[model samples]
Target: MSLTPGLRFSRSAQYVLLSNVAVPYPARLPYANLRRRLNSSSRPRAQRPRGSPRTVLRRASTASETKPAHGPPAVSVPFDPKSPGSLSTPRDPIPPESTLNPPATTRPPPLDLPARGPDVSQFSYLFRLGKAYMQFYKAGVKAIFTNRRLLRSVAPPSGTASAGGALPTRAEVLLRARTRHDVSRLPVFGVLLLVCGEFTPLVVIAFPRLTPMTCRIPKQVEALRRSAAARREASFRRLAHLRAARGEKAAGAADGKLVAGHIARSLGLTSGWWDKAGLDSPFASSVADGAVAFLAQDDALIRSGGGVGGIEDAEVMLACEDRGMDVREKEVGELRKRLEKWVRETESSSEEDSKDKVKRLLLNHELLV
Candidate 1:
């Protein structure tokens, strides 16, 4: 048997640039579209009666009658075969050629085969209804895939209680929806097909490789992350004490009185500022030096800087660090000398957030753990 041509039809018949022949319109004749007759069929609409055809199954038409109307004409031609005028006369058929062919088909028809006729029973209403239902079910399955949000209403809930519990996160809801079927709980065949149609195929195809792959991936990722975090924590611990000490005395972090308070808090010194003889004295510098030693050991003392600690509760930690040296120049006179020096140093320091760095240093040193 000859192969069918791979040609396709199009309703829009724009001129093709590569070929000389213009193809038919996607519907039918291409020229018909140019004349604005797009819906025209082989038979015009008016020729048919108003009612549509009721037949569900169209009977196959018999093949065309190809026999000639009359027997072949006996032509009488008397002309030289070499002359141009010989084309005007008809050539007679060869007697041997005509006699070689059989009167009908070359092979006999199969008599044993059942005859084909109009089978009214096959086209009965019940069969048509069943066919329609099958078509609808197939269409419904396709619709489920396309409109996936419908699955959310039908997904099986996990909790034991009939009443709703806490709402699931967006991630949980979306993940559950992928395999959920609205029909899954229905009284249907085997109850498995009642599950999501798409979910069924996924379980069949990917279940072998998918389960093991999913299990291994998160474990590998978590272990890698935890090990890296542990390494970083260890590295930071090594630097915390050094960084805290350096930050306190690197030429101009805070006034001597302020440092004294930090030191007294870290060393648990008698909540220093007891009277006029308190933080103002020259001995405060020595107390401050001692404070920086343990400053990295406890975050409680340093956290008293900007966020917590009260002016009234001197027992907790001092809050005067926020005060500019100008206010304490009289009580802590040495601050005047350091004030100008501190400004110059602060101007020269890198523009990083000093407060945040100090906070991190305290936490790393187990000051705020």
Candidate 2:
């Protein structure tokens, strides 16, 4: 049977970049001065030393340089807008070199002018609200469209079996879905489906002892879809297989046995039956019994007298390997190829040794324990 294609994220990344703006740079202060006054009053006249010719000349030179005949002092301090209090400090007779260069003025934040109306604040607020509403409307419309598409995809195509007819196996539906849809065109949609498919086997494999009566059904489809889609896009987990197993458990919880069975039946999971089940976070024997009950209901579909057809257990297992509950189509073709090789090897074995080769192999791998 054909395998599903790999999935990828869509144009949604473009909107992510558009939603935020960059922060503005801050301003700096220029040429500032600090001065400390000397207490001349503390020194008594009797304690003062007599001035020599060298001291007299030095004092004269400093006085002459400090006050120029023209305009202002040669050394000027720049004004600071941020802290006007600095202006109150007295200047020292000899200022630091920093006083020569004024600090830069702080620039005001960029003015965001409103596109409409004389009252900019009012206009800006209204504009933001309008954009928000438009975004909400777009999201709602997109969600409706996506749900409709998914429903159509899940439903059998023209001339296929009706709702109550003998359901197809999970393998058959997947093959058909792969053949009909340009999975690449579906963007993250394909990945979401893959994740949903992956969940079943992961749960079976990872938590074989836990059974499945205690998983919680997810309340948010969007969250589930987005998560699955993201996993497909970001295929870098070290233990992807293990992660998929956990996700499947979550999916089982989200899709109660009844709804899940109905969905499975609709998708043609003929090998199974749907039974009522309950899930809580903690493990419970009662919940396992509930799962057994659901599986019993699916027995009718499994026992229908139609031929086993083209699908096989290996195919179903491969689908689980590929789609896991976290990532859709992340490892689809790889698992399918592996299963196909196993099938080929099984077919080549002698009649006496037909001995359920897949089952033997799974046993060796501890996959079916």
Candidate 3:
């Protein structure tokens, strides 16, 4: 069973991208010119006395360089040697004392640009594994179901002798089943690993906000199975408890009365509460009409009772406890009685079926173990 051509193509594209990101990126200086300017301003200025001819000459040269080169040249004005007199007034607007020598316009400290997140190359191994797994899964399932006709031929009805020595025997059919089981299981395992490998890193990096739902397909499937078992157990227990409670109520037992009174006390009581405060209620209400219809079988047994007898329903019920309406203790007890009877009946049926299977197996074994 080849992978869907599209999936393979997409996976290949991902690989190319992953590999590209792998080639190390050279360390680059994005703003070298701005950085150089900032560094130059921080140097100390010369502190030579103004009276020195060399210092005076250097200052004059510096001033000449700074002034506009195309403007009119300075004209020599007669100086009163004995009197201190100002020269031509400064033409450029005077900078404010506060602004004139403001701190150097140091380029804002080189922006501390955030580091780029890890590159996609980090996911290559996982991507490859996922691709392989998906391919195997697609093929494996197809292989098994595709040969159903062959499988049917190998598995014959019990007790009927075949022209060719009991039609390869039941044990032979089971062995073939086991082979098919491997074909099914391998792909499933591969898919599981692929899914985990693909998602685990993403969850780790994303933390709380983007955490992957831990229930991946494989884990979810396993969890579903476990939940199914728990559901079955919970149903059985609930039914048994209900039956016992109902019997006690019928017998005028104190426990039954106490439960009913407690339920009654809790019905329809509203209280002041802070916005986030939590409270517990002891009684629950159902749509009375719906409950009647449920009991009346207007819907299928599963739909009406909401899986009261099925594993699926039991699971949903457990999940709803935190959010669902409260139930009256007396009603709960009565419901439990009916469930307990149903459980006993189911168990009895299963036992009878098991007995029948064992007898059939023994009879078949006599001919071909």
Best by lDDT: 3
State residue 127's C-alpha deviation in candidate 3, in Å: 2.5
- Measured against the true structure, the TM-scores of the candidates, in listed sequence, are 0.15, 0.19, 0.24
What ranges in model 2 sit over 4 Å off? Answer: 1-148, 157-172, 175-337, 345-355, 366-369
- The 10 consecutive residues of candidate 2 with the worst lDDT sum are 101-110
Report the C-alpha displacement of residue 30, candidate 1, in angstroms: 6.2
Query: Against the correct fold, how does model 2 do in TM-score?
Result: 0.19
Question: Which structure is stronger by TM-score: 2 or 3?
Answer: 3
lDDT of 2 by residue, 6-85 (tens): 32233344443443333222211121111111334455545544599789788878974542111111122232222321
RMSD of each: 38.9, 33.1, 36.8
lDDT of 3: 0.33
* CA lDDT of every candidate: 0.30, 0.32, 0.33
User: For residue 35, what is the lDDT in candidate 3?
Assistant: 65
Root mean square deviation (Cα) for candidate 3: 36.8
Q: Rank the candidate models, highest lDDT first.
A: 3, 2, 1
Backbone clashes, each candidate: 6, 18, 8
State the number of backbone clashes in model 3.
Answer: 8
Candidate 2 achieves a global lDDT of: 0.32
